[model samples]
Target: MSDDGAHGLTIIAFIGSVFSPYYGWSRAQDPFDHCAMNVVLYGRPGRFAMTERKAGSLSRSQDHIAIGPSSMHWDGTELTVRIDERGAPVPRPIRGTIRLRPSGITAGPFHLDAGERHRWWPMAPASRVEVALTEPGLSWQGSGYFDTNDGDEPLSDAFTSWTWCRAELPDGAAILYDVNHRNGGGRSLSLRFGFDGARRDIRPPLPAALPPTGFWRMPRATRSDDGRSRVLQTFEDTPFYSRSLLASTLAGEPVRAVHESLSLGRFRNPLVQLMLPFKMPRPL
Candidate 1:
């Protein structure tokens, strides 16, 4: 799937889950926290996906499944994925690679719709992203580029989203999202958690009664030239801490994006996260 497919649901669920808290709607609680896993792959894209359809709901807990080719390479310092899906009778094969380092990640200059070599191209063909990791999975900063063409008219915009993802082993955890360059009239934020290993789709509990041990603060915020805005989140929880960087495009004609992020977690109390029955402890 493209960057905005099923996995996209994960973010949607998260947004819905924490919609009230992030936007200052719910004062009673905050967004639920969970583990952040990175499965980077790139090379020969013959069609890969986290879900089947383009508009499917988030997968439930306990269901962690991604299928594609073996075009991913890990050099320990940087994980790289390259997709090259072009020139074919069907959907065009994909070949790309993702590179990740303790400091940051390098996605691509890989080439998507090079020379009419594929059956399809992104809804928006002119999208670019470049991220620099200043502190591994804890923090980072970067810029994104987006562009599109529609009947004698050209549309272009840029935005960003920064995230801090960290999980404690035994229980405690935290995450934050700062969004910019939104097309909709109103801005929104949300978070959610589900049982471990279950499908990544499902609405997370709202106004959660659980207590958080760490501290959350929006120390800074700013708006960009394209009407996109950015918010800063800082947090600290025992045994874990997380930070994210994000850049996204407006949700209008010819959608595009450029995003950067990082998450830090060290496996803490499971009770603090949304775990499925399979991940729950047995009754003594």
Candidate 2:
């Protein structure tokens, strides 16, 4: 998920399993069996960290997952994130706490197919995030967003490309979700939800391009009502995807947003597959 904090934006993810045989090295039965915690600090090059842990060592009881010094607990009312550790391979020590309280706005567990192969739940379109970083001794509180996505199938098999973004507005928040399926079809959702749970469908503007990423030129774009968008920071840029912080307008309001673009077609490429092991070495 994307977290816009006082210091900067951060993206944390746990990619469990892919059905492809090429991913056999993961040694996972269920895709969620073996997982890794990936933390990306926007605008901080070489500060990213990924720690691998067996799913057995991780506890998932309802809304909490505890593994080592990091844990994420969500009890519907709030989401609490705690991290305390020195990163491997790079040795960057990161210790912090992040708390998110829902603003009472939410979107659907929107299904992409009749069989419900893909779905997303925008749990909190807008929320208050409190931050406390001990290792760096920084703290701030601000607006944040949270969402959850789950699918029965591998993303590369279901979609060719997708772009997603969330914007925090004055009275509420907005989300733009668009995907190009492998069957030459597409789906788009542009929604604005208020703090009181009111929802509106918005007509997303024409897509605008951002600067091409390094090495692979991962395509990145988003819809803005004013036809103006700027990529303020590029967090993680790989051959097939990119996560960025952007400044743009949605529903006639200026917003700073966390944006992401994923190209599953390129992710399926053999060359890209070969590079995965370098960044995701097996856990010792």
Candidate 3:
């Protein structure tokens, strides 16, 4: 997201694209062989692309990683991402470069699951980013964020669904993670990270249910000060997942946040898996 909340971009490099049909039918060995660089640019004429590649197309170094023609490199001061991909279900060119500089990098690898098999790291809760794209003739500078999540087991085997959001604050960022396990237990984490590298665990207000997506009807919820939140916009609406822009009150202040809801139960369904290939086309 940009400083004024007008432009937003999301990029994720996956080592075993959990949403991939190719990975679902594989023998489950050599996870590295199933990889992808997923990128989505938001605004007028928005674009999305996620094409799973093979290990032969992946290259990794201490500060650099490349999958296919897209790559991300960190030079100690800033992270630079070069995207050269085609939007799926349409195959239109969606090339670009994104640069992110963090206000402060948080120390993490925070546990999510009880067994510690799943983890998350808020590397940069508050950051600044500049995006320049040629394919769509887009350019902007704005406030942004970066993070990483890792899980030893597939999400479907461990979770029923989850809701996550990061609320921008005056001096830092407030984050919430609510995870429901398949076996009936769940956990919620609410924390604040300052731009000066301070981390504080916060007791979240409470879960406030928001209306479901109009198309997919994916369930939605988040926490707020008044115990109420509303969807400002729905970005991505898939059969199993949804990303929304939310207007809510947190810590007694009004906040505009990015929210996501994922239903592993829907994702694991064979029918939904078939639908994903249309959006995340994988070329063998």
Which candidate ranks first by lDDT, i.e. highest?
A: 3
lDDT per residue for candidate 2 within 146-239, as digits (tens), equals 7777887777778899999988888888989998888888888888889865787677677777877776789988889877799987776888
Which 10 consecutive positions of candidate 3 have the poorest summed lDDT?
Answer: 196-205
Lowest lDDT 10-residue stretch of candidate 1: 6-15
Q: Clashes in model 2: which pairs?
A: none
The runs of at least 3 residues in candidate 3 whose Cα sits more than 4 Å from the true structure, single-residue gaps closed, are none
lDDT of 1 at 275: 27
| Candidate 1 lDDT, 8-40, residue by residue in tens | 101111212211112122353322221111222
lDDT of 1: 0.23
Per-residue error (Å), model 3, residue 87: 0.7
Q: Is candidate 1 or candidate 3 better by lDDT?
A: 3
- Candidates 1 and 2 compared by TM-score, better number: 2
lDDT, candidate 3, at 182: 90
Clash counts per candidate, in order, are: 90, 0, 3
Q: Global lDDT for candidate 2? A: 0.73
